[model samples]
Target: MTPDDLADSELPMLSAAQATHLRALAAPHYREGHQYSLESLAHTCSRAPEEHWPDLVAAHFDRLRQASQGDESAEELLRGVHARLLPVDSVPSELLGSLRYARVVADGLVFAYALDGPTSVRLLTDRDVERAGLQALGEAARANLMRVPVRHEEVGVEGGARLRSVYGDSPFVAGQALFLAEVAWKVVGERLPDAGALVVVPTRHNLVYHPIADGSVVDAVNSLAAYALGAHEDGPGALSPRVYWWHRGSLTSLTVIDHETLTFSLQPPPHLLGLMKGLVHLDRAGRLATRAAAEPAGLEELMRGAAESMDRLVQDPATLADAFRSLVSLAHARCAYDPDVAHIDTWDAWATATRLGSALFTGAPAQECHLGEDLVWQLPAFPAEPPADARGWLDALYLAIVCRQTDRIGRLCRVPSETLRQDDSVDEYVLHWIDTLRAYFSDGPSMDDVVEKLVATIETSGRDGVTHAPTEFVNAIDYQPAALFHRLIARDHDTFAKALAEAVAEHGGYWDGSAAPRARVALGPLAMASLAYDYGFPVDPAQPCLPAHLLNRQRLEEFS
Candidate 1:
């Protein structure tokens, strides 16, 4: 049944003429198990105004008839085929027969291929796939789909949440969610948050998404769900009436359907629930950090707020590694804005990040890596696999180095350097820096070799670059860490201090008007400074990004 049929009490009563036209259209393709039964046709056209039923039915069949002719050359077919997301039940079961014609994508959705023409899109049958000699039809269709032009409008909602709706006259707009990461990046550029996004493809022409950055997601979910249900009910081309969580290229349905009752509700799975809780915690911590920075006299009260947020986050074992990375950013912001009052707060945040990072990455208990203690010496076994993204690997490496756990560093370096090169999403320059740092910390390369590789990476990154004021450097974040790493390994103390200040200043300028807490400070540069300070290198304590207390591990010494 179509989405509207699930909600309506009865399908629109079909006139004799409409019934005859539908049957005549279905006759050539009619088989016992096909989806073209009289009832199914009525359901399909039910959402359209009754007056338009005949045209809609005839147009759908016309496209199918054209698709069945299959006389186009393989190259022409490949160029015209595009992936479409549709409700699973909308496609004929007979067409799906063992041939990879349709594959289930989300809970009630399927990824199907279609041939696009000027006036209509035709669903490809098994015959179309055979004619094209395609072994991986889905892959080819998806590749072609990405070439479609993407356009979106940003809609700001209540509670500081923002939604980006990708909509156009193009029939392929809603299917862009299948390539969500690339589409989102294209639409929002670097502004898309690292925690991923919450998406709803309400109708075939509209895909709405909210990047998961703050506590607003709690409300955005309900808002998007209501929007989806309404749009699905009013559609000429309805897809799934559900919300999905898109993270690291994987899509998970966040809407649960109770088929028996013909009802559905939004309920995030365990992993997504954990991520949502993490976002909320980070949001609260960020507010407290901002307040503390702006009002240093109320530091104690703000610290209490920070403690409360941390307590709640600590209680959830599913809190993601990215959350801790944000926490580290908040900690560095406190040091940057009000170092004198933030000494203890900075240590607390960093210690918590290291403790949580150990637990999340190594599968160790948080208690084992207690706060206010010398960093744990007995490092747990590092995972055999590297993290899925550059930031994750960097977070892991930062935690290991800050805690002065060289054994963990060695273990991290052993997890296949080739894995770092696999993800095309990561900048090649960033990967070079990560590999160099891993080699430096593992003692696999001499300090000279490390400096040489890092310098080359930074110089190459800046060669075609625009310089941010205060320094002749590239504005990209990926290369800043490398620039700092080069300064440190070469022991160029003056340039290191100069670069640190410039990097911190550039960071603030880059995210100047943004509300994301992750924008407040440069975690990467601070992490690199922490390494230098640990090695007895002279680090200017007052550098805004490098919290002096954190660099010295002051609270660990005092409290222990």
Candidate 2:
């Protein structure tokens, strides 16, 4: 570990590309959080000057949100939480503008995992990270977090040749997280030092489906992540660890993050949002004037009117032509100052009113169901490379989960009585017969065995006898709006991390990490990007820069 050892040391000097990663890992020197680095970043072709690499890019985007504070020019749009746009031009638009809204305005997200081994499986939450505490979990995590120092595993199918394009001082996960967090904080602190409050919170939630119940084993590695987010020196921004995981047959553990006004206004497109408000006006007009006298006739007449009104609103086709322009105008008015609505004043109000009316009229009966947008949940995307150190991934997952909950909320005007409230706890939901199920799923050698093991996992975990948790965590596999949800949003694996936890706690997976095929660092996001492009899901087109080679996971298009 000494300089003299650099000459005689087996530790290899980083390759040119690796050096670039290293520089990024080391970029926090000018920020308050990081100490100085010995290696010079100036001449390496690895470093970008500090100005171009200004601290947290999130702040800049957020600043744009603040600037649009009083844009009262657009009245109808500021009226409600969502729009009521439908894609009835005979077919859907190739690139959806909706997904882009979720991608950018996503308040927070969570991605969790249920790791399985020969012994047991356990839940890993991304939301409850405590940085220092996790950092103190000894060498394994330290080594993994600073993985930039080591060579990446070869993942190409053809041969074992290493991927030399992406390199780092240590592993890209933690090292980059620390760098970004550090620099981002300093920059924000500098920009808004006196007027606003600044604090960083890491959410705790688990992603990953597993049935393992061995607390001793689970706590050992999982606590590392918990500590990282939980143990900050001082509160910086509003964040906390959030996570998702799978337990038995359920998806559990969702996270929530504080949403800035701009991001809050970007979700819930018009397709499913055209219900409420339009009816409010009808209510005032005493439109349901003959409910007592006509009963079904009155209801039927109301439906006919609502439909005709909606038809006129769209059928004429002269209302609004560009959807994106409408959304942009809406985002500014809503998020900049974060005010409450006194009247249906914004441009989006017309749409929200229609949605409100539709929903209110449709739900006159008990236990009734109304259709909404199919929700596609996602796990967290690691800011740095993966396998993300548990702490970093958990934090990202926590954010992702919060975003999912926001999505869930967007689909609901008011949560049903059965839905898990923000007050639910993990212990009360625990399945009792977890041990038997965990043992049952341990040896399935084939896919068939994996299925049997999974079924056993569900049965055994459910034996805990806990009644009615509601559709708190509905399975995308069986949800009613599954197709449409997939059309708009795709699952981030971490979104369901908790779904497998109880099952794993009761009965573990049949295989271990060593048995499964290895994954490429590029695997998850690459697949996501391909899906995004193919289906035309909306994503923020903003390009994120790193210390390394230009381009961001291909999410940001390359500049040729």
Candidate 3:
């Protein structure tokens, strides 16, 4: 007889209403390649005849609905079910074992290909985990797995049995170790002997389960190592290597594997545990591990504070500048007082880039009086005082410049630009400026001469000239300050002069009852030219320089 014609005891003990609701939920999934249904779940649930199968199915649907609404605390849901339903008995075997289908975070469902025999299992990779109520669970599991301090240098397919043979499913590598082990057991545990299985774990890459062929964890590890090194004739003398194992379901380390020594350690080393714990917090912050690796203790909290402060003051340019200045100053003071602070040099570099970049692209002051703020931030940790260690200071300056330049390039890329008249054309001269600055910062024989030239350029500007009137100018706030827009204006002063006139004419003669805004607009090209020149880029006065054009016009307009 068909599934519908089965006896009442063989089918799900659901009321007609419950069966109808399940069919409605399972209908859409059935069309989308999901093979599970009330009938199929009943058939699989019958295998564990002692369990209350209907209650288990109801609980699964309840959890799925909650998970779909963004509550993905699966463990909590399971605990609640255990406490409420069938409280006298332990958790049902149907809940832990085969349930016809297991739904992951997205829209995919894992199905039991065989429930009673070899217990083949399969999960759909094509379905969307986010829509299927498994995305958060998947992400959390993936994040936890990434923090596992397992390193793999090489990955080769050798004599390891196909994962499909054991589970009728290909190897799956994403998600937490515990979750993966659960999937493995649900898929192939019935075929696996009761003595337990030997799992070959190649670091964080992939896991292959070998049905209980070896007796103990030590023997299992040794057998895997021998298989890994069996191809000695293919290369130089292949040596025995350390590998990991999954025994009964828990991850364990197998280290110090040689001809004489096979040390089986149940716990990961202390240092690795510390690093992994730090990584979990960093992952939550959406940051890379470079800074966190050295100083993982409070970096996430510090970054959160900085982000919150920035969000509040971003609209108020002056307030933002003040806050950034304070942060840079504090960081510099800390570094100077204690050079041994974890990754302080890197932190200083980041702070300096932020400070100088904000001043150039935003409207922060950069006077010689305030140059100490920048200098102090750039100073590297030297073993002795200067004169005897002058080179150290210079090295710090070089590194700081590189950091600043890279930061500026990234900022320019993110900002929008309306100045490019042609899409295909680029401003090549800006690239020349970057290369020129790099040369000046290099350790060549003419480095001293180049340094002198750069110092003279900044000194000639004088403290007032370098950081004076521009601080009062209104930031355009429209575009990210990029070289393309600046070069477009500087490509030909006459064309730019006409463009400025056109902009002013379009905006009703650039008079908002204030010369400050109009002057800032008119002298925008000049400000860009000044930045280039200050950074040691050569600008010919006779050429079509926007600053020179603006200067001559300012005298005529009597705006200065």
TM-score per prediction, in order, is 0.54, 0.16, 0.20
Residue-level error in angstroms, candidate 1, position 405: 27
Q: Write the per-residue lDDT of candidate 2 for residues 1-560, one digit (tens) a residue.
A: 54433421111233444445445644543344223222222223224444543343334333433432222222211221111111112111332231222121112322212222222222222221122222332233333333323222222212111111112331122122222222223322222111111111231111111111111112222332343245321112112333222222122223333445411111212211111122222222222111111122222343334344434434432221121122212322232222222122221322233222222212211111111132111111112112211111212222122122223122232222123222222112221112222222234345454344344434432324222221221111112112222222434333322322222221111111111111001112222233333444443323111101111222121111
Error of 3 at 18 (Å): 18
Model 3: lDDT equals 0.31
Better of 2 and 3 by TM-score: 3
Superposition error at 175 for model 3 (Å)? 20
Off by over 4 Å in 2: 1-107, 110-211, 217-226, 230-240, 243-560
lDDT of 1 at 2: 43
Which of the two, 1 or 3, has more TM-score?
Answer: 1
**Candidate 1, lDDT over the whole model:** 0.62
Q: In candidate 3, what are the lDDT values of residues 150-177, reduced to their tens digit? A: 3222222333222322211212232223
Q: Highest TM-score: which candidate?
A: 1
Candidate 1 residue pairs in clash (backbone atoms < 3 Å): none
Ranking by TM-score: 1, 3, 2
